[model samples]
Target chain A: MLINHPLLGPRDAAEFTCFGDASLLLRPDPGPNGEPDQAAMDAFHDYLHLRDNPAGTHQELWYHEQGDRSWLVVTRDTINHSIIKVELARNVKARNLKTREGAG
Target chain B: MRYSVFSILNQALRGNTGWKPVWREPEPRPAYDIIIVGGGGHGLATAYYLSNVYGITNVAVLEKGYLGSGNIGRNTTIIRSNYLLDGNEPFYEMSLKLWEGLEQDFNYNAMVSQRGVLNLYHSDGQRDAYARRGNAMILNGADAELIDQDRVRAMYPFLDFDNGRFPIQGGLLQRRGGSVRHDGVAWGYARGADSRGVDIIQHCEVQGFIMEGGTCVGVETSRGPIRANRVGVAAAGSSSRVMEQAGMRLPIESHVLQAFVSEGLKPIIPGVITYGAGHFYISQSDKGGLVFGGDIDGYNSYAQRGNLPILEHVCEGGMALMPAIGKARMVRSWGGIMDMSMDGSPIIDRTPIDGLYLNAGWCYGGFKATPASGYCFAHLLATGEPHDNAAAYRLDRFRSGAVIDEKGSGAQPNLH
Candidate 1:
């Protein structure tokens, strides 16, 4: 009888390729349903300050699932599926912090 | 093809849209009886065992991402019960038993193979260690056969068995030790648990934990807050981070570990070969790729991707033993994060915090310990007491210089 390969997992298992930064990468495959979920853009805006930028590096690829489970935005090349920069998909100022900072 | 971090960084610098979150709508839930923190193998299995065996329903396995997307999915899929620690020995051995009956238990074929595992030795001292381990295994009723060079050749002739460098002395053979279908283990648990009223909540992240009078009442999640009588943390790679959110400390270091698989080939390695002399081990995935891995990152890292040096060292050790492997093309490689404790043995005990329990510190052997760990952890949850065997793995042990040093290293590797 023929045996299947080890890497061949179930159909829905998230496929991943590793670059620099982070463990447990679980970013979802984009949906075919047309509209993108723009609800988490602010999360992508100020991720560098949250991630604190890796040593000697400025911009980083941060998929928020490591613990935040918020949103992770990464910049990549269209030609090659490479993660150039990653950040938390959500980066809203905390309500208390926003009030404390006198944003009003 | 998926995007690489390098090109993603380039695009980000050029005002290009890169790494962004794909958010899905949140699903509604009233409340769950038992809520498992991380939806890895142990979490899922606990849910299955909780509902199937204990008859307790209304369970929810909350995963920050899709199921089997964490360390459970990233592991090398090697399963063995060759641990030398107390409680750990019997515990892992029991997991091997559950693996033996998993197809019947979960009604899913996990593809468990008892193809045997050989721990190689280079020097007499190394050979002596295997003897001790082998003797221990025999004493514990495990099937361990000490084989000589001739015996090794008879079993596997393709191995470079001659007067080459790093000469092969002998090996400690665990005839029953082998591998299993890893992701299958995940799905089997998911299906079994789902069928028994266990709601597996995916794309849900647990934010800070909810503490009531120093007892963990429940958790505050990204979706919302959840209340539970008890909570378990089987979050392998994210153990430290998850615990941190609960206002606790864990004696664990997160490190990156990588596994590589070569292109398909004719049969070469018939069984799992562990090079005890170095951080090297290789096994042929049924798909024909030589799946192998090595030590954790020397430095602390939560990053799943490993450095080049470790990948080089692991492959070097493989090439040293199996020279024919030099021509084999490396098809793919990936890495996973591990919450490595000071000692390799895991900690399965109730914390000072009431109703909150920890089953972390799995090191590199989490896959092998899944069933036994889940059973024991479930017992801890139900009775609020650590089993007699697992009681020794307490947080205070790390403080009072009390430890069960199985490998006797007090800390990390050099475990045969």
Candidate 2:
């Protein structure tokens, strides 16, 4: 499998390592002081454990370990392994944070 | 009729024409006392034990396809109880015990070969870890022996003992651990359940759960809606998709695990041997093919096929361990989806939904845990209590901060 890297064209998937679901980017916050409450604990548990392992399309995190050392959010089909889009995880995180702030 | 030496001789004398079908093709009934989703090994075994041990004969096993089409036949059929954690060792030991007498108990030739399983240690640190693991297995009433380098060489001298990178230091051996005919297990259990008046319904895909108020009462299948007093889902790889219809999320990711088989050779490998440095394990089947596999594809996939990267990676591991395998040509390779659970351990417990039970998260280890998984799931479904051996496999354990992480990978499904 070849993952199209945003920085360097398409690269062999062996050069990159996968970290499963892209939801790991949205890690739950414990608190301002890093001391978690009961709700925070539950949020952290679900954040780390539960997954929407869909059968069709999936957005996942992939690291260009052997090349650029950049994390990329790759939207791909789980059934056929066809990559639809790839972007830097930093941009995706920024966009998500902006969307969350806009919602509030 | 009961299969025996007399039966074989009687059939042989009559020109071998009077053998009946092992299981019947039964249509779905409107309702049953219990409904088991997924007619894989664990599902069939659950139905068999429910009727044989628990005497609950009003059961129906619904299959999306033909039986044994899942990981039950896809795994590199090795079974062992060499575990370090308390939560896992006892449960797998129970499975090993069940495997010991499975063929006779099911009255079928499952070919349960107790030729032993060896996990080779490559370095001093790995040897120490194996020693600790072997001790834990011994404490759990399972046999484990930490053998020296000389003993390992004596048993299998073809190993790359002098290789600079991964010199064989020693190994942890489970004398009773070995392989079984994988599909025979499914057939045996299906036949056993069918003889007990349980219906084996094939091509009956469960589309969704029939929820009456807050409790699950039945399932809508490809055939029709069937009601049940209780429902147990033993779906291995499709656990996430199957349970999603019931409005539940599991701590599982489906990944494709591929297995390979080489062309027929003479009887070489005596038992199962695992490469400690890499994720490769191999055994010689009775048909003389070398059966082997490595890690999952490391990505979530419901595709029952894998990519070339993992296949090449598995061959590299095999070549690194046994260089002689490089000369053999790989004949066939296939993939099965694995329900990889966070913390690398399985969950066999009641779901939040009432009257609905789950037996999933076997990951790639589902093949070895088939018997105990079924027995424990059956026990839970019948008595509404977790089996003593499986008490630690609760779904709420994750929420309570008590995950049974055998690999200590910390919520990473693929790493396990």
Candidate 3:
């Protein structure tokens, strides 16, 4: 409901967080069409995920008000909650979207 | 607020049990202002709307069989407005609104259970699709949310969480989707309409159209010929055949869909869950049994009975998804032939023939669509114009190759 849409909540659009793991950017979604400069940010981007963040290195959280019962995929900064990318769960789905954070 | 859609629909069914005759032919009326064949939910609903809303009281509903004994009785009652396309989204949302207030409107209960429906996704691509659907649901003012495996586990703790052939990835939750008593909806409308002086003609099997020149003047039925200015064919399975006899060939497929219920399983499934990736869904009835169903027999069939394939396929899907349900014994299963359209959507528009109306091709989603279907069909019959959403379900869409199929996988309901 905010013009800037800063505060993400349960009723807003989906918010996905990815911390560090940037492999998703390289994994050819648009295939040959998405020719990223071959040099992009592979550095750790703080992401927020409730429990299990799909990848081993990427820790993240996803929230979606406009999503199938499944949370849509999102790329955001974990520290500041700054959203980077938002994708449908189908687009970035890898097994389950999350698991519980173990002993870490 | 005290009652949901399913709760409302169920109460109506209980109040009007056996209010209608099993089978009787129709008597020829000198001039019935309106005649609606097939006393299913749609027919009864149309009659009620015409009398109450449009002030058209000289309505006559001619039914070949008992009321609600067709698609109304055989359908697996699942309702939601989570449509991705323009054609289905709004119409279904409208239907949901009608469903929300049917109890107070009819002064009868239809016991609509707003337990919410979940469409599960197995892969990331499917997750993305659900994400979009969730957005569409919210945009359309439907209650929806997306949940992951851990959340699903918290919600449905009894489910088998072990990873398998298709592990639980995520699901699109439609908090507004749910179930209703199928028969209650039909009889409630029938009684409500009958109270308004609308003639209820049962056992009146529509034989042919008594066309005067190019207009539909009346209908020739098994009992006798009845003259009517406005004729609506709401016959479920016989929709295509009735249209064909009327000199029109429609793009309708007469296919049978079945529903199943297992012997009481101690309240397992709390709500309705439709597997988006799988072709099965199960919900626990109030009696502790699991009332469930799956996709139809892929081929076209008019038989009231279905083959073993659908039953087996549904059971397998259920078992694969919910491992604990394996022990539950299949109690009973029944089939109802639906007027499956070229596209999985419905066709609720006026026919080319003047004064002749068509309200068929609901496919498997009719139960959820009953109230809206009736509302839209009534508007079309009264004003002789398509309701806002019926514009998409034009009969010519089939000819034009413009199908508004929702299950983009193209498997239609059969593949669902």
Task: Give candidate 3 regions above 4 Å deviation.
Answer: A1-104, B1-28, B408-416
Comparing candidate 2 with candidate 3, which one achieves the higher TM-score? 2
What is the i-RMS of every prediction? 13.5, 1.6, 24.6
What DockQ was computed for model 2?
0.70
TM-score of chain A of each: 0.25, 0.92, 0.31
Top model by TM-score, which number? 2
Error of 3 at B249 (Å): 1.3
For model 2 chain B, give the 10-residue run with minimal summed lDDT: B407-416
CA deviation > 4 Å runs, candidate 1: A1-104, B1-28, B408-416
Per-prediction DockQ, in order?
A: 0.02, 0.70, 0.01
lDDT of 3 by residue, A1-104 (tens): 11122233333321221122333322322223565333321111111100121211222223333433444444543223344554454555443333212311
What would the per-residue lDDT of candidate 2 be over residues A33-86, giving only the tens digit for each residue? 899988898888888788888989899999888889999999989998889999
Residues B225-282, candidate 3: write the lDDT tens digits. Answer: 8899899888866786788778775555565678898897676676788765567888
Candidate 3 residue-wise lDDT at B255: 58
Q: State the lDDT at B109 in candidate 3.
A: 76
Q: Positional deviation of B55 in candidate 1, in angstroms?
A: 2.4
